[model samples]
Target: MGEENLAAVLHAAEDLRLEKWPLPEPKENEVLVRMARVGICGSDVHFLKHGRIGDFVVKKPMVIGHESSGVVVRCGKAVTSLKPGDKVALEPGVPCRHCSYCKEGIYNVCPKVSFFACPPTSGTMARYFCHPEDFCFKLPDNVSLEEGALLEPLAVGVHSCRRGGVGLGSKVLVIGAGPIGLVTLLTAKAMGAATVILTDVVEQRLEVAKKIGADGTLLTGKLNEEEIVKQIWNLFGGDGPDVALDCSGTEPGQRLAFLAPKPRGVAVMVGVGPPEIKAPLLSACLREVDIKTIFRYCNDYPAALAMLASGKVNVKQLITHNYKLEEALQAFQTARSGVGNPIKIMVHCSQ
Candidate 1:
């Protein structure tokens, strides 16, 4: 192993430097991974551009990626389930098992959780990195590295759907045709949602949603939020969706998620929007709709990997761009620009 690893480090907003960071050693319960693929998530771009996501701020130089898959190059003595050479999809958050949340299996909300790319914790945008062994899921031979890297977003969708109670015969409304929204759409379909309606301001994104089989697509332009909600209701044949997921993290989209669901339905807030949201809680209360929210994810990595292995969900086709790790700055530029109809931009580190 090299003494130093190449990594994309974010020093401040819009400041990313490719520097040689010292190679990390595996802890007793960790495994050393030679990263193969790393996907640039919206949060990653947000951190690069704005230097923070809600309360998590980039106080110092931090490695800037989390959606990752890699080959196990070494394992600590205490790592029993996996050995060297295992291809794995990394679940980036490691919570304190002693915490009450972790004890209850909702560790995603652990107050002391250490998550990649979330300030103070270095991430996997490097040639090599080390993570807790249990958090690294072995990938099946049929699941490509690219697909493995995609599981992070897919897991978010899975967790959101689980929270929203998306199931057979459920009608779903997904507000946002971004990567997360698209994954939510795919998951809703896989979970047997009878009808799925998706909305986005971007026609290109809506086109992707349509190609991926959203039953209805709403292009929100010039229309007021109420008007858009009316159209969304009309799209569902005026019966309202059984579950509405707000993946856009905007106030309007979240308001749509709150108002577009049926009585006693579920509305999931999946994206991180402004710190203080102004959604109508009383309106949802009047309708008796359940409002659910999720953090990153919890106990979903295995299920997501299974979906990929079984071909239940297709993530390979969602990748719209790729770049070597060295081209990370330009890649971030492209991701931020929102040009080229880019859906998922991935950065590769190794074979």
Candidate 2:
């Protein structure tokens, strides 16, 4: 292991630098990890550009990254599940286990969670950091470190599928063909959805979604709400889909999620958008379309890894670019520019 800990730190909006952060040590129940791959998320870009995500604001310098995988360098005395030299996928958010939400097995909403790369919480875009042993899942022999890094987003898809009740012979509609939407499409198909239609404003993204396994693709670039709804119904045998997932999180996406589902179907908000958006609540209520929202993920990492090991989901296809820790700014630039339709950009943290 190297003596110097290099990290991608954000000083303020649009001010990112590679600084030497103090290497973290493992605590009684944590393990020290040498980070290998850290995937850049949309939130990371948003924070870099604006320095705030809703209420979470970056008031001081903080390390930035969350979707990461690494090898265990040292284990705390109480970390029985993992040992040195173990390769693992890190679950970023660690919640207070005593909270009511955590006790109910829905810890993703625990108000006391210390999620990586969010405002005040320092993230894992460094050579070494410490995490609770329970939050790190050992990677199967077949799963590469790159794939392990992707498990974080894949877990979101798994959680969305479960929330939307996606199952055998189901028909699903996913809005926005971005990384989250693509993963949702793959997860729905892997869960045995009979048909999965993906809608996106970007033609290139829709094309990628089709190639990956979307049963149908719709380019709703200029289409209005009614037109999109009509097109979606036509794509699903002249009827709405059994489940609709709004991965875009735009007002239009939220409205369409309620409008594009069959009566008594499910509508899930997988992406975080504005604090408030005008949605068709009355219409959804009349049709009995249940609505649900996802906050990160809970108890879904194992399922995501299992899907990867079983060859049921291939997340590597979503990765469009890669960079080293030193070239982090360039990577973020490519991601922010949307050049070449970058889907997922990965930053290698370990030498």
Candidate 3:
């Protein structure tokens, strides 16, 4: 209702400030949403702490948040799917429809895509934000705004599972136990994975994974590469898993997952880590193991929403802390510390 809305802007590395910004208006195909909850992502922390993630650099001040949900306050004349007072989850990435990637239905790989909180595109860490009407999926009455905000990350999990070819009775090993890892575990289980083994160096995170229905949790800190492989074999009852999803991008995690799967098994890399690592390619090549890597996600929002609405995936448990927009810096600090079981930290824009 006012010209200015509160926004958390990252002016420089590790220097985030809450400021007043003019509320954005909806375009012909867009809708204006009053942001309710914005989840702090690992990428957000990476950009804040290091100022850059690979090629994308924070050259200018940008609002920092992508996983978000909000209430539609205004709709453009041409917007038909959503209306004022509708609660929805914003997909955050707007791909160019003219590109071949978009035409092929894999718009997440569109080179010209504009994603929120990414280098040049401002994010939804503000009270009032405008997004394309088609990108905002209306939330069901049963889903809360908090659950809606988590749909962004859950979409990634769904996408990763789909890419990994997970299905009924599939045996899955998820490496990482972080937010994405836990979500992937949940997705696999919901997809009918008979056994889901989660591995993480953090005991607390592994404990959380066990609480979330991981058939087994492995502490990777005490095991070396070969021992880790042995443990996974044991978890699979002497037979390696059918699918191994590496949600932890660390070299060790990748190595373990690569060696822990059965011959001709599928190995999916879902986490962001170093560009290159000394992997055991010979072993993988000898076994005909299929190695696949997932980009952000493609066309997964609807499935994520459906899963949440059906109660197949309970993401609310992932949230461990909440902060007002003004306390974004502190929130980032807490996330970076990783002291307490901080699975997800949310920032309330209206607070």
Candidate 4:
């Protein structure tokens, strides 16, 4: 028999199965990689629980993971920068360079892009996969495959901060202490935010946020919207944060993120949320508070990989659970149950 690949296939909502699939070969400009680690992203969980994210539906069985890192097993004839035995992080989305967005260097939203685990396109939750060589970035010696996988989300933090203009002496307010929020806090500080206040409904997540880099933690459970606004200003000495980043995506959270920013301050919506949202947009506009949104990330992986390698960002501490790829269903269950106070669940595939 020819070589086969083991994949974690999601057939329907909460219906994931382990199956032997065909191993892929590299194209002239592609490289075949043996996936070593895949981090479970929020969108992965959303797709499994709902079978779709807006218009992207899973009409066919698909392997379901995008945040991944692997070792190069083989390289195509045209791929010279990467060779056998190179460890690299896969940039899940491949854009057509001919598109206008790609030409503008904003290919993350290129309409024709094929993003892994997003539907029709298969993903890297398998023993082996083939991807374009240019999209697979080599990892530094100090970075682990797991850390390499995290660059995907860190890129989001980087993109969001860049859009919000987070920099030197900035006072930032981050809503939601989930993985994304924590990452934003770290990125803000790394970019020189002098003070950061983080809010979350979960105490444990707040604790983890503190351990990472948050200057202040606010448990948002008991506070009303106005109270949250009051408390946030009070935390920063009765002044609003210079920039507010909303990572919660909840209605109240989004509204509060915009409200917490100083007049003329910048606020961003980074997390994916319900299709429709109601917030104080008119009020924000009158105050000249700039409200922006973050799609996926683009052109930030190189910096993110550098940050991970130089110890500027420590994603290792964010991982709370680890399981072999064979136990992927169990890992998904743990993530969905919200039990074990799991911050991040990782699936090791190479073993």
TM-score of each: 0.97, 0.99, 0.98, 0.98
Task: Please give the range of 10 consecutive residues that has the lowest summed lDDT in model 3.
Answer: 2-11
lDDT of each: 0.91, 0.94, 0.91, 0.90
Candidate ranking (TM-score, best to worst)? 2, 3, 4, 1
Candidate ordering by lDDT (highest first) = 2, 1, 3, 4
Off by over 4 Å in 2: none
Off by over 4 Å in 3: none
Prediction 1 TM-score vs. true: 0.97
Candidate 1 structure lDDT: 0.91
lDDT of 3: 0.91
| Tens digit per residue, CA lDDT, model 1, 134-175 | 899999899999999999999999999999999999999999
Q: Lowest summed-lDDT stretch of 10 residues in model 4?
A: 1-10
The digit string of per-residue lDDT tens for model 4 on 1-351 reads: 144698999888878899997889899999999999999988999999999999999899999999999999999999999988899999999999888999999999899999999889989999999999999999978999999888888898999999999999999999999989988998999888999889999899999988998999999899888998989999999889989999998888888977888889998999887888788888788889998999989998988888888888899898999999889999999998989988878999976
Model 2 scores a TM of 0.99
Which segments of model 1 are wrong by more than 4 Å? none
> Mind giving the per-residue lDDT tens digits that candidate 3 earns over 128-186?
99999889999999999999999999999999999889999999999999999999998
Which model, 3 or 4, shows the larger lDDT? Answer: 3
Among all candidates shown, the one with the greatest lDDT: 2
